[model samples]
Target chain A: MSGREEILGRVREALSVPSHAGVKAVSGEGVRDVRKARGFLPDGGATPEARLKKFRKLAAKLKAEVEVLPDLAAAGAFLADLAKTEGWRQIASHRNDLTNSVLTSLKVPILWTDDEPGTADLEQVEAGVTSCEALIAQTGSVFVTGKGCGGRALSVLPPHHVVIATLDQLLPDMLAAFDLLRERYGDNPPSFVSFITGASRTGDIERILVLGAHGPKRLTILIVGN
Target chain B: MTSDTPAHQFQEDSAVSTADFEHRQWMQDALHGYENTRGGTEAMFGDFEQARQTAAAIKWEAIENLDTLLGEFADKLEARGTRVFWAGNGKEAVDYILGVCKEHGAKNIIKSKCMTTEEIHLNPALEAAGMQVVESDLGEYIVQLREEPPFHFVFPAMHLKRDRISQIFEEKLGTEPSSDPEELTMIARRVMRQKYCEADIGISGANFAVADSGMISITENEGNARLTTSLPKVHIAVLGIEKVVPKLEDLSVMLQMLGTAGTGQWLTAYNSMIGGPRQPGEVDGPEEFHVVLLDNHRTKLLADPEQRDALRCIRCGACLNVCPIFKNIGGHNYGTTYQGPIGSVITPHLRGLQSYKHLSFSSSLCGACSETCPVKIDLHHHLMRNRRNAVQEKGGKMERWMFGQFAKVMTHPKRYRGSEGLMRFGAKLWLPFKGRKLDPLKAWTASRDLPAPAPKSFMKQWQAQEREQEEGKS
Candidate 1:
């Protein structure tokens, strides 16, 4: 048997045992019901209007405290302007085409590198920008597959993360979004796919939401219009 | 409060603040573990309620039908040319893991953070068999250095402060004192880098095992888990039977949910899916791979419809991060391998109800854990069920008697009203000595003020209000 066949055959045999009782075949669509099966309502309220209202309310409540940009271009400009204003020393982006494109367009003076971000560079770099695979419109989430986007650390470690996502990347719901992902790539997909809604925020100590506890503090989403 | 005082004996270990080097050192270590785990967990759960439901449902689906999927998984694993071992309990699991280590002549073994191994206490057994086991995960490494059990699942060193870590590293490895987190991380990486290279075997926990390809998936940011499995000659994974999913497509939904719920991320830095070792043209990976499927009270848990959903936990740590009780007291306060809402519910199931009788009541039942769980385990309700089971069925004789008496009085209003005056008489007699040496109220009086009893209870006031309303109408 071929290598793929051999591996898949093992998976089939392992799945064949009487012990694998819960091993029901669920399609990409069934995965949506799995999320609903858990009885999870999206972050805001149930209705789309309510969810939108809640998102807006939450954004407004935290807007003054947590930074929000109008769009991806404005976000990029804000980050660029912030870099200049703050005298940021370095900038980093994943080796993906879109991020490289953004870096080319922005044409900032900061030393831009598209290599794997290490701890030392992450500390020195003032900003990190990357193109995202998917964005959840409801909660302002951004998804990045690890292969092209310099993996998880590039977005997580840097203090300021500016994600450039296209309009078509936006998903109406998380269940629908995940379904789309599975439909595109089967079980053995990429090594990593990250969904980042906002910057690293923690309320662990006395329930006071502290940004940059372990990951990036400021996350600016740049929704690139098609 | 009574139990809290013992925890305060290690008061210096609390990770709430960096106040003084002595106390703050402990707090930083604790906070480090808390932050590490919470960061990862929140990233995975994204939204607590959504993640919790998804996790709970997925887990229930996995376990309720375990008999079929596990068999399929076993078959798939064997077809991949990997060895599969079914361990009925902790002893069997430990025996199989140690046996694998011994068979490989594994003098050194590097491990990622696998709680099931901890549940089975595999390390000591491996050690007893004369093999050195090194935890490659940074947080687990710190806890190993401190000679303490893991406080948090994801971030094991959460209970230790940075200064304490500096002191440990300084003592063990002759490193200098530094409280900076980056410096601490570098220090750990520098040490673990060596351990990873020389180890003969790699051991890890599976986040999800894809039945489609017999692939064991592990999610991590540090890349240590990858190194542990990939670089070693022999790789062994210790997983609960419930970790298996039927296909790779199913694994995607889990990865997305696990990523968000565990650390509030869309995905982790490393979502490694390895099927049995290196193939024909592979450059690197283990030569031999074995997965020890541990039952260890899981079958019993699976039998119960109410408790079976707890198995769906991706171990994302989101529930622990959002749990108010866990935040204040930390994971050790629960006194089990699992901690927080899920821990409070699962510990008794795995260890049985006798030793961990007090673990269930530790939660305030605020449902924060349930609200935050990525798989939606209904943690709060399960916690309540654990408490009810404890009182009605488990041995809480005194508690049951007190509640039974209280219930009797509550149900019979006449008897309750008649006893109210007598209760007041006792209160009046006890008041003069309050806050003094002669005070009967020791614990309550020392911590907070006991409000003076109302002259008339709400029931009496309500009755008077009703009479006034009737008079006015007439």
Candidate 2:
């Protein structure tokens, strides 16, 4: 059966099951009742356009926050310049062509032959740049599939992270992205699919969004257009 | 920080008021966190409808032919020299895992974030058996330190304020007072790193188990997961039966969605595909590898097609983040391993409908969970169905009578019409004695003012309008 059919059938069966008989059962099933009680109602209005409007507004707000680079080469240049300005001697890049070429062009001494940044002399490197498999324009997020980009440390260890992505890789929303992901990776996608919105940010310290927590502080995105 | 503290008391409370209050707080915090994550996630789901359609088709096709595919997958995994154990439920699953730990003499066990383990309450079981289990994932580790269950599925510690974390780190790890997130993560990393290396056995939950090559896939941003599986001498992977897909190609498709949807990452840093024990040419891998295929209520979930969509969940916290109820109460207030919309539906199934019957009432019938689900699980619908089931199958005598009276009053126009006058009379009568508030309506009045009942019902007013129109026309 199709997914919709399968799901619909289950819903029908669930509805056919009995509801509580009286007040005590309702009170006894308090939290659970509230949860289950809040399902779709026939009288409930249709999906609201205001919700979509809010989503659009939020997306626009995020786009404003993230600096969108024009192309891959431009992004590479930006990263190369960032390293140059910082006066860093050593750097790390994943073994992918775009990453390797960018690093080579910059003429920085490369460490950690493997793609993972953790293996590199993290203390020595000022920045790390890797190619992203997907770029989320909605939140200015970039994903680094572990397959091509080495390991988690590449983004985590470096003080600064420069992620490179083509605009074609951008997905509209989480739902749409999953569909594409399934198409490419199937049931067993890569071991890790990092959904990075901005720099490694965490508010766990002081209820403040402290960027550069166990990961990069300065996240530079290079959005390559089609 | 003290045992006698309000925080401690709150945690210990079994009362509904305290639980509701705490649950509300959790939901708010989670919603904010979700807001932060959603921005980046949306960008990754560029053509969301197309992606979902494709994913649903792939998943449906796979499930339809799951039997044959599972057989093929079993053959391949066995060929790779990994022992696969099929457990019927939480008890059996935990037993099989503990058995592995015992066979290997594993004293120290390090684990990545696995909801299945949480569903089974495996840590207490392992510790009871005299084994030490450490959560290696950053969020899991933080929650473990707090001695709290996950508040959010993807970001288990999302409900925790940074101050709480700083306090926990100071108390548990004796860290310096640094509320900086970076500094805090460094502390967690330094602590978990040691656990990862010292671990005798490693356990993880698979995002997907590829039947074609018999490969178990683990996706994560933290290196701890990879370290846990790779550094340990023996590796044990516990996964749900519904996690299986027929081929590597199909597995890839699901991962695409899971990776982006779960955390808004295009892909996580590590996607480790383990094929049994270390092969001839492999440099680093576990000496022994075992796979436990957990069936716990999944076959039953599959039997009922609608509920099976719950199985399609990739443990993404998107729904929880968007859920107003989850934001308010937090994960712990639910008093179950799973939290939020998905948790409400799944908990009743996993633990039995009787124990967690109240969980269904925690929601406001919001369809946010359905909108956010990566696999399109109709969490809202299931929640409603759960309510119906509770009333029909598990309701008490008082509940049945009250609802029956309500149904009768609602169905009868004359009785309903007369009830309006009674409400007004009652309101006026109680107003004098209410002393600025009605005692019976205290809960309702606390958050909102009670509207006075109308003199006439809407149905009655509509009938009057029809009569007036007919007379005017004549």
Candidate 3:
């Protein structure tokens, strides 16, 4: 028999034996609904304004730079100013509805992710700017997918991750985020989905927090709304 | 002092680590920060205890129905062009992984931090086959350089200070020594960047496998796992069969619970899920994806309804951190891929009862591990059960005979009174040896003093008092 069959056979054999001690199992024997998590999980607030407030507080606590601009034009101006201040010569981004319009007039060399840019090219770029699926308010996470966010490497390879998300994209918690993903993608979800909470960090050395361990050091979220 | 015999090694390493007060201080200080953060994070939950119940219920649901979930999980991966392999044991897992590397003609491979891979001891096998393997996690890389297993699960090099890390970096990579944590991290980051770009295959361990969606989820504070999955042309995820969850939505609770328990964070910086290789519309990812489902004695664990709850562990390392025995003897002393309460309970089942049973005794029976368990695993009681099972399987003739002898002596009133003198005489003999190994009760007397047998039997004093009272009344 194949290894799969043999292993499954063993599993079947194992579960077949009755408990000698008559130990009881969980209340529901199979497929416990994850939706039962509503009571105990950390709340993400009921109102959008409340969620945004929580997001801003958490994002700041995690040391990610969050800016709520009035409009996309303002967001672009803010990002362009950030680029000039940080002395960015080259930028990496994908041509999506949000990022394309945001990067249109920004003066910098561009490494478009849609072009299948080389690793060396992405590495040399100052920052990776991609649009996200949603922003998680409770955990202050930015949700991205391989198909939606210029593949996986764009958000990961560059030293600075710049996410330009609209205010309407903010979701209350991970539960809602997962629901949105299911409703949108159905059975065929993106091969890679991530909940990027903050700038990449590690406390490996003497319990000291060090950002940009392998991915972006600075995570800048530009939440644009009129 | 490390020995081929695991039981002896446990003793030798415990003696060595406990004596190093300076090193123990480092471990204590590191865990202190973890305690504060974990306490603060737990308070943020609306009902942390209720959440644990939900977490436990979900895990129970998963493990009890293992065959169906594992089959469904595998089917989901295969449907998306991911070749799924079932490995019965460590050798099979190693063989399949090496075979994949050969098929892909892989030269350099980058690996994320994973205990399952550690359990199988994969790196040595890969190196022996002339493949270069690099550990991408900062803590893991430091331990790899020092040629040591991780000091702790979550913080792999938790026992080391920055000075030691810089020394290793300087010697191994010929980089200048710097005491700054950021500088040390930057050095590793620079080195790993090249490794990620050049590697042909990326191997990872999953925190959970979503059976409903057919995806493997990985959680990490650093993005090294991210690059490992994203950059390489071939990606292989090796995980135990028990990692399955019924659906993707389950991670909504699992991830947060794991984060609060493991490192006391709201969530680790990266919680990524991969269901397939690069999809048709995707621009860049590994062309081929492989998921290796390793049973390696887990099915043996699942079959026992009494101990099956131990399989619900999410590898958060919370139990180890809070365990007093683990705090003292340390991770290396356990001499297993996993350490502390969960390790003690499950190692015997995974390896064997007779040989590894000593681990079950290396606990204070404090139940702190059980109290703190996010999934509410009854860890301390499980340890006691391991001990019971060991004694049952391999009958302890000497211990059984001695207990029988004591039972006989206590039952007869004449013998019980006469044994008082015998016990006092026996104490005199045992007093001289004190804590020496020759003393049969050295385990009790090693660090404490047993008071000299009370000067007079309490029975004689009580009899005298009763006679005096009767004479005065008359």
Candidate 4:
């Protein structure tokens, strides 16, 4: 017998349950009910304003910069000023409409990572900016799917990452974020989904916090008020 | 490294580790830091007890229907173009990986930190096949350089000083010696970044496998797992069969509990869920994705109803951090891929009771491990059961005989009084050789001073006081 067959058989015998039990048990439930069953809301009040405030506070604690801009134009201006201050010559970004507008306003040399740039090209870019699927307030996490981020390397390879998102993307907690994902994607989800809480970090060496370990060292979030 | 049996080796290994002053100090400092921050992070969960119960229920339901859940997971993954392989043991798992490597003509492999791989002993086999394998996690990298097993579960190089790490980097990588941790992290990062780009195969272990979505969730503080998966053309994830969860939504509870309980983080820096190979429009990620579900004695563990709860572990390493015995002896003393309370309960079942029964006896029967467990597995009770089973199997003749004698004397007052007289006489005879090595007292007084026995029994003293009161009243 194949290893798969043997393993499944052993599992069935060990648990003393027949095959296809789980499928039978879960057929009646809808995704909404499943979401409600394990709905875990963070301690902060569940409102857009409250979530945004909590997100800013938690993001700051994680050493990430957060700016709540008035509009897309203000976000663009903020990015432009940030680029000048941080001395970034070129910024890599995806082909999203919002990302395009911000990059166009900055007037800096742009590397379109949507075209799948090489590792050497990605290394040369000082920073990368992209829009996210959702921003979790409780943990200060940005949810990025493979389709939304163009590719994983754009967010990981650059030394600095600047995310441009609107207030509508904020969720109360991880459960709400997963609910949003299920509502949007249905059964056919993206190949890769990541909940990036902060810039890359490690405390492996004598338990000392060090940032920028094989990923971005600095993360700046531009939250445009919708 | 010792020729002694596992039972004897455990005593010797623990003795050596317990006496190492520097190692003990390092463990104390690390555990204190963990204790200070863990409570605050766990408090962020808001109704953490409810969350724990929810997590436990999800795991229990999934394990009860593991056959169906695993089948659903495999089907969904295969439908998404992921190849699923099931291995009954470590050899089968290793053969499948080597076969894949040979098929692709791969020369170099990079791996993220995974305890399952360590359980299977995968590295030496890959190196024996003439492939250059590198461990991407900084902690794992340090221990890899030293050719030693991880000193702790989460903190692989927890026993080493910063200067020792600097020296290892200088000798191995020919880099400048620096004691700064930030510089040390960057040095390892600089070296590993090139390896990520150059490697042909990338491997990882899943923190959780979502059955409904057929996705593998990997949580890490470093971005190495992310880089390891995205850079290579072929990505392989080796997971234990018990890592499965029934629904994708259940991930929220497990992830929250895991982050807080493991490293005292509200959430880890990165939590990645990979469903299959890169989609058509995606520019990065592996071209081929493989998921190997390994049983490796897990089915045997599941068959016993009393011990099946051991499979609910999320590999958070919290129990190890809070365990008093683990703090004293350190991680490497366990002489296994897994260490501490959870390791003690499950290792005997995974490996066998005969070889690993001593691990069950090594504990102080402290319930600290169970109290700290996010899933509430009744770990201390499981250790007691192991002891019961071990004695039942091995038949401890000497212990039984001694306990029988004590029970006989305690049950009868006449014999008990007779023994009290004998003990008073024996105490005087053995008082001179208290510090010397002797049969019964040797083990007790090896490092301690035994208190002298009372001159008279407690019962006799009570009777004397009663007689004095009666005479005074008359």
Question: Candidate 4, clashing residue pairs?
Answer: none
The pairs that clash in candidate 3 are: none
- For each candidate, report its DockQ versus the true two-chain complex: 0.06, 0.07, 0.74, 0.47
Off by over 4 Å in 3: A19-32, B1-4, B430-446, B462-474
Docking class of 4: acceptable
- Worst lDDT run of 10 residues, candidate 1 chain A, spans A19-28
Q: Chain B of candidate 1 versus the native chain B: what TM-score?
A: 0.85
Of the candidates shown, which would achieve the greatest lDDT relative to the real structure? 3
Top TM-score model:
3
User: What does the interface RMSD come to for each candidate?
Assistant: 8.8, 11.8, 1.7, 4.8
lDDT of 4 by residue, B1-474 (tens): 463887778888887888888878879889889977888886776666666666666777778878999999999999999999999999999999999998999999999999999999999999999999999999999999999999887889888889999999999999999989999999998999889888999999999999999999999988999989888899999999999999988888788788888998878999999999988787777899999999999999888777787788898998999998999899887888889999999999999998998888888987999888877777888899899999898967999999999999999999999988898889889888887756368867877777877887788899999999999999
Q: What TM-score results for chain B in every one of the models?
A: 0.85, 0.86, 0.95, 0.97
lDDT of 2 by residue, B3-39 (tens): 3632343334424444566646654654665467655
DockQ winner: 3
Tell the DockQ for candidate 4.
0.47
| C-alpha positional error of residue B155 in candidate 1 after TM-score superposition, expressed in Å | 1.4
Better of 2 and 3 by TM-score: 3
Task: For each candidate, give its TM-score against the true structure.
Answer: 0.66, 0.68, 0.96, 0.95
Better of 2 and 4 by DockQ: 4
Q: DockQ winner between 1 and 3, please give it.
A: 3
